[model samples]
Target: MKGNETPRSTLWYFVVAHTFWKNVEVESFLSEYRFTIVIFPTMLKIYRGANGKYTLYDDGISLDYLQGDSVQTLIKWDDVAKKLSLEPASKQTATRTFQVELIPDGVTKRIQYSGRPVELKF
Candidate 1:
């Protein structure tokens, strides 16, 4: 309920990967009443599952921040891999998995969008 924290009702859960960039084994946590604060310079990746489930990956530069599904900030985004791109889902078919890393603008690097989960191999 704080100024920086988003509502817990909107978020179901979130996964975070901190410092362990080599073989990231992200941790998943159910959203709680308390606020999840993430420090600056952290990179966030939001993804949706194939069965229409939303997931948040908080790749912190130094800390973690869960429950940011309501984050609506304007920023540039680039596909993590050239082979993967974000596209609209067809009427009869769901979109494939893809990931787009947020490009930091020195202000905010978080964004809420529609994306599918890619393997956490990074």
Candidate 2:
């Protein structure tokens, strides 16, 4: 995404999911979908910044979705099950973010993400 591109200017929704893992080296599947991390989970509680960015407290690791060429790409899930699989493991504790375009007439109705402004068409 371009620096000049105001994220809120476009019609989009943010999806957040989280889970915990005992001893798994999970590669956060972020770039596959378009989303900037507002917070990431760690051994303890999740630490979120005032600006909606996230980081792992103890580990000092931050989740950045806008650093690479794959940041603007969209991911396709075959079905609801597939989408659920993408969610962070609920048992442990992790946070994942996803950006979805709003389609007013789609069968799966679109809902606005909190704090995001909505654009109305006349």
TM per model?
0.18, 0.17
Query: Could you give candidate 1's per-residue lDDT for residues 1-122 as a string of tens digits?
Result: 55544533222223322211111223333355653543222243433222122222332343323343222222222224312222222222222222334223222222223443223322
Best by TM-score: 1
| Tens-place lDDT digits, model 2, residues 1-122 | 55533232212223223221111222222353574533322111111211121221221244433342122211223231212112211123323232222223222222232222222121
C-alpha displacement of 75 in model 2, angstroms? Answer: 8.2
- Misplaced by over 4 Å in model 1 are 1-7, 10-84, 92-122
Q: Residue 79: error of model 2 in Å?
A: 6.9
Error of 2 at 96 (Å): 4.3
| Superposed Cα deviation of residue 103, candidate 1 (Å) | 11
